[model samples]
Target: MLKNYVAYVRVSTTKQFIHGVSIAEQRRAITQYATLQQLNIIDWYEEIQSAARGRRPVFREMLKALKRHHYGLIMHKIDRGARNLRDWADIGDLIDEGIDVRFTFYFFGGVVWRGTDKKIERVFLWIGGSPP
Candidate 1:
């Protein structure tokens, strides 16, 4: 189901690049995961800069692409890929538009969440997953 995915991986600093914290690792890992699932990687993205200092304009551009209904997006490490609520909101936007996002580190909120699409009751269920 996630075969048609684009892999995104990033590291914030040159030190991370030289020290083996690189998108190459993300590609390899995503490739492996995709292979196991019998999926195909349609495209890939890598950023060698920080989400905090804004070294990933391209990454943001790519997120814009995700809104076009790309099947899935992959990130080797969640923190390396994003750093705040705005960025997370952007990610959620993609999901709301029917894009599946995968993070090697974070599990997302579990069920897909869309402020525009979800009913208030569904929102409540999502918020209170542990029901009585």
Candidate 2:
């Protein structure tokens, strides 16, 4: 059986709509990744607010939904998933509860698994380059 997954796409600001990777681009990449991984995306949560901000209603909604359904989360990148330590910690908590969190981008030349020392090690080594 295919694992049910939820896709999250975010852009920090309205300005990003013009300059940075648009929501469409993130969604496209996530969709392709989901297809390659054979993940069944049962829902999608898109947000336009910065992850660094104190409040992200859509993100909270996604978290609530995940808690209820136990679906995996697939994000375009770590930045898209979380830019603040608090939010990152929330993701970690979900992982501790057996929720799978996946990033489509590779960091430090390798796959980054949630709740692993390797993920911590590679994130610090990340030099902000284009995804491979």
Candidate 3:
């Protein structure tokens, strides 16, 4: 059976909107990645607020849902998922709790939190062509 995942995408500034990193683009990429990985995306959480400013309602909602459902999380990129240290730490906490967090961007390779050592291992899985 395929693992259930929640997809989270965000765009903070107008610059990002103009640069083609719109929520739609992120969603599309995430959907494609999910399909390729054979993972089932049960829900989507999108935030237009800047993570740097803190207090994202949608993000908080997603976190709450994750805690309750124990579903995996897939984001377009690390920055989209978390631009601040606190938010990053939250994600780390989830990983520490055995929650799976994945990024759609191939450039990120893959991030895994090892046991008690707290070591992070990067497993690169390049699909095709050169790195973006």
Best by TM-score: 2
Pairs in clash, predicted candidate 1: none
The residue-by-residue lDDT of candidate 1 on 3-99, one tens digit each, is 5877787777778776675656667677776675566678777777778754578788788777765767777665766586566557666766777
What is the per-residue lDDT of model 2 for residues 1-132, given as tens digits with 9 covering 90 to 100?
Answer: 999999999898998866778888888878888887899999999888877774889999999999999999988788887777778777877787788888877522266544345654355335354432
Whose lDDT is greatest here?
2
Ranking by TM-score: 2, 3, 1
Model 3 per-residue lDDT tens digits across residues 1-132: 999999998888777765778988888888888897899999999777888877799998998899888999988877886777678667777776778888777423464322122233221212123432
What C-alpha lDDT, on a 0 to 100 scale, does residue 38 get in candidate 2?
A: 90
Question: How many collisions between residues are there in candidate 1?
Answer: 0
TM-score of decoy 1: 0.71
Q: How should the candidates be ordered by lDDT, best one leading?
A: 2, 3, 1
Q: Give stretches of model 1 more than 4 Å off.
A: 53-55, 105-132
Candidate 1 at 130: error in angstroms? 15
